[model samples]
Target: MAGTSTFMEVVKAAAKQGSAACDSVAIRADQKSYSYQQLVSSAVNISRFLSSEDLNSSAGNGHLNGACVGIIAKPSAEFVAGILGTWLSGGVAVPLALSYPEAELLHVLKDSDVSIILSTEDYHELMQNVAAKSSAKCSLIPSVPVGRTEAEKAPLENFHSSHERGEEDPALIVYTSGTTGKPKGAVHTHKSISAQVRTLTDAWEYTSSDHIHVHGLFNALLAPLYAGSTVEFMTKFSVRGIWQRWCESYHEGIKADDAITVFTGVPTMYTRLIQGYEAMGTDLQAASASAARNLRLMMCGSSALPYPVMQRWEAITGHRLLERYGMTEFVMAISNPLKGERRGGTVGKPFPGVEVKILEDESGNDAPGVGELCIRSPSLFKEYWKLPEVTRESFIEGGFFKTGDAVRVDEDGYYLIMGRTSADIMKVGGYKLSALEIEAILLEANKDYGEVVCAIIVPEEEAKRKCAEELKPAITLDELCTWAKDKLAPYKLPTRLFLWDSLPRNAMGKDEVVIKAKILGSKLKQNFDIPSEQEASNP
Candidate 1:
């Protein structure tokens, strides 16, 4: 049969190129390395195991159709194998996070309607219970054996030759982080995945020579692998582990083939890495900085990257951290360019082939200036799972996905993400204030505030004690005033401040400040005996 040439086909092709040419490392987990061929063989073996169990069969049918396989494994070679195996068996790969609670796990399994669960030994017990509750069969992903003999090896054949998959066929179903309400599954098709992989590979210039120290899960790992780059998994986010790995790559006597050249992380991860760098002794800091400087690229996203944090990071590492904006709906749409001037405060231009426009209020017209950022991209998701009305309402007149983010473009044509239009924009005395802007200023004032969330606290509450407890800012009222006095205008600044241990966030890592404000606003008015809007406006 002719070679099945696609993203998965690339893996098979790499395998046929022999142990030396395909001699590249595929995964680095627990300080050990696994090669590309091993990954392929493991995936094949996993597929065989699934076939043997007839897990893919429905009502005793021998053939496996498009069964959903729930993969509950840590980021490792096994996890990769499980995903590829599912794909090879014509099954849907559902990547489950280890961070999910049992209830959350059950919810995802139930929603995806997974037929079977393939998990690592660490998660065997947990998944067993989840599978029982969801009525899905469970199995342990067998470890790939080393040193395959001729007799043990099956004849190399094109498994995907019979089935031709289009780009729009669903390849993965990734759940949102679920910081606020219930988490929703966002589906990405083969084409979108291919587009994203190509975009990232072209943008970052990922090559076989590049060893990417991937800090996040699923998309981050798969994208690099799809681009034919080596991916080292950091299952746990450890500042020391990351810095030490970078240093080892550059250190003497340890001239390893696997040198981490690319790094991508969330805002929180970067902030922690900076803090960790600060805590190190001067000599270690110098070495760490030098090692990090040698890395080809470092990118940040998933949340707004504070300007202060970006500035500090550049000063310390000698590399300007490239900040971009994206959501789960589309893996990525806008990015700060890899070669050009990457602005610290802005998320740069639209990605290649992506079209963006800002829509104005009242008129609902495509205004040239500032308003809600709407996106039209080939990579945009099909729809929210099961939410037909939401799916219908999310698009604009031109089929552009309404981003729900308020944004503007600078003279340089860089896109600046103001914040989420609904939750991050606050109305104060007829003026609109950006909560992200205020939060950025607050981060600058005291980096120790860590995860900062700014919201409008409306006035009125029945219980004074409860109101006081819920409506206080993390920083003292005096401190907040002193901090904002110089940075913001009288109207742009937040009048009401409420602080808690942390802010409520939704699945996409967005804070639900609007909902909080509505609750707090009602309480504040009642407590202060303030007049209603009608009374206040009339009087």
Candidate 2:
């Protein structure tokens, strides 16, 4: 591609010089190590196959020329190869989350108009059906074989050199969680993706020395790879497995080659980890804490980090979780400084080279300090795929994308996200309140109640035991109101309370607050004689 270098360029350049680090381990998954050389070789072979007449008659000269290639695989070497191969064939790669249901998966496949679907053998049956339903061809991505002899090597062809695809050409299309509505495909060009990876690498100070333990795909995997760092993948987030892995990494004061130096997860993961720690024995706690504290960096994102959770995690691990802010539209545009104080309940400053504004209201007025957070970044997505009208409405006159998040600058110039304007913002008795702020306080209160507010799934027997064990009565609306009187205004108190073993969450671990609100609204009207919106706002 012209005017900018893709990540593949850096990989190829390092390979050309026969750099030892370039051939070092790139991905560690399922007790297997995939080297950079093997990754590139597999990608090249896949690119050749994609261009062959066997795949499609339209694929002349083996170049995708920006066609869409749907990639379906778990976090593994084959997934990496699929993405690289798509780029090598000049095709746009769209990573379909495995957690999506059949209908949603089919929606995305058809929406993106994917020309081909590449997946591993495990998912061949499912993907073939999806491909058939979406009118796309399907193929199994070959395993990336290790051990390449020098005689078998050749000068790698620059995939974009022949195709007229430029830096602005579409390279990736990632769909959002679609909690509120149908998922929209966020289109990211090569330049935008490079900018995001570079920003994250610089912000997190990623290097070859860092071994990242990734719980999810996307930024976690791609950023480390771009920085030439080793990535250890955990297909599923197991609290026990994570703690055990850290202990094994630093066993007997000996740091292994695969020692985890960095780890990132959502707030729920941290919350679970804290619960797991509390359940450990005294001796086990000491060892787990020591091992976790030894890690160079521990980060959290994808949702707000509760202050109580942060404090408890720091007390246990001696590492204050580095919290950052991002969305599917733009990978990460703001982050707390790696070497500075990470304030709890705040998502630090705008990232370098990113501009932010506050759109206060419908008139596009800029509030003194609080409003909807608008962002213009080099890493911003090109457009929402095939939704030009929606995409056009998403941006302002000067290209700042409306984030739909209400935020304000603290006295120290840090950004504090109030909450999402749609769901988190609530009007009560002529006053506006932030549900997230109240939820944080409620979460902290749960700790004081001396009973863990586990996911509502605890068995009835366990619930009875917990309630009986705690000397205090169960927390009630009145009790919460009394507790919060000092911290919040009268209108900010939660008028209703629904205690559950666990809050419902999407695949990303974010609370399905909007949907829950609708369910709650219906129940409130039927059982509690709750006033309508207009009535509530009046008096």
Candidate 3:
């Protein structure tokens, strides 16, 4: 944490070794392959631009020199280059999600006090406006040319190593998905970033020969790149495309040169993939299953994985989904093992250097052994940016970060997340119940309910017709209790139910449970002939 820069170490190593040693394709996207040399070349170019005399003068300082650089680009070579360039120029990278609205983008930009915004041309107009709103300078990220000659490449001469940063310097500021409230920036340092990437690389057995398929660019992209693995990026997640790609990779019983060995995604993606598989014709389903099973690893995270989804996926693909627990504060801490039995409904033991403990609830009212899951790891973020008091409160006396997740350990010492301490744990009749556990049980019990759960409004006339066509009445409180009678304790059953269209989800595919509950609760009150406006006050 004192002397070195983690990302720069990889860059410098690649640079010193030249093409052959680091020459494997580091990124494949949009039907193009980019070598590690090309990626480093592009990053050096961007670094030079950032350190130019004119730009420095305009920015009101000599150089970025450990300042924040807001990056707004889709998952591509440009995004990776931008991050590397920021690090090369002694700046921290703050990746602003493209999925964020203008207001949310501005909020993050202003909150981090970003010195500059580097975005692709596609979002130039929008990013310009966002930059204006946040008072941050804007620049276009030059397209990374493929197979370019040395003479044509941007030189790193103008870039000064005098601004090089230490491991303790801030390297990234990723905002939490604001499902609860306003998003908070979690600041990660170079040391923490290195620890995370190294842990994942060692745990997953990543290597230069492996190819990882990634959707969004967080741990999925960065970790593999750090391990010198080739990363294939998808512009967006498509169940059909994913299956088809896998099928293509292993066509004619031979593995293609660009075969993807590892894949990671959220639980909802798997659920959708299962739905896609089920809808496929017999022959196509067989091909998809065979292709998917050949992949070395499949992982699921971001939200609790439903048992049914995991079971069905394994039944089809033969690979049990390795479920893991992580948060924005720490990229990853606990994960189901790559070699050992990956048990369903439990995130396995801590990573090699990570320490975990279950802090018993002070109320002493929870079910035995249930408490807040706490973690102390080298990979833990430095702080919640600009919120010193909040950051201090988040950790206990021994530097264990309170994860705000309720968890209980299984007999084998694997951790089973009960739910979020605030939102996912519901108190009913003096007993705390995990909404996720209930959701999982409901998903299995109601086979005819299909893939989705939760409520949404529809036309009153059409709603009745649809209910009749489905051959089931709108799921009612009595119906839910009757079905959950044997599966759940009486207190754990849903007291109220409104069968509607769909659930609201955030960008990361996590269900917005708190917001949905409030909306559905309000609608239920309205249906009961109570005033809608009074519902909020009553709750």
Q: Report the Cα lDDT for residue 28, model 3.
A: 91
* Candidate 2: tens digits of C-alpha lDDT, residues 1-539: 67655676766554443676657788888878877777777787787777772343465676677788889988888999898888877788999889888899899989998888998999999999878888788999998776675622655553334543578889999998776467889999888888888888888888888899986555688778877888998888898999999999998668988899999998778888888999999999999998998899999998888787799889999999998888878889888889987888889998999999888766434356878889999999999999999999989979999888888789997888877775455454544555566666656665632232321111121110001111123777677678878887765555555554444577777765554445455544544323233222100
User: What's the ranking of the predictions by lDDT, best on top?
Assistant: 3, 2, 1
Per-model TM values vs. the true structure: 0.85, 0.90, 0.90
TM-score for candidate 1, residues paired by index = 0.85
Give candidate 2 regions above 4 Å deviation. Answer: 53-59, 146-164, 216-218, 362-367, 448-473, 526-539
Instruction: State the C-alpha lDDT per candidate.
Output: 0.70, 0.75, 0.75
Please count the clashing residue pairs in each candidate, in the order shown: 16, 6, 0
List the RMSD of every prediction in angstroms: 5.8, 6.0, 5.4
TM-score, predicted candidate 2 vs. hidden true structure:
0.90
lDDT comparison, 1 vs 3, better candidate:
3
For model 1, what is the alpha-carbon lDDT of residue 321?
84
Per-residue lDDT over 337-421 for candidate 1, one digit per residue giving the tens place of the 0 to 100 score: 8899998788889988899877876644424577888888867887766667867888888889887888878898998877666
Tell me the spans in candidate 1 whose CA falls farther than 4 Å from its real position: 1-5, 19-21, 52-63, 146-155, 158-164, 217-219, 252-255, 363-368, 447-476, 497-539
Deviation in angstroms for 487 in model 3? 2.1
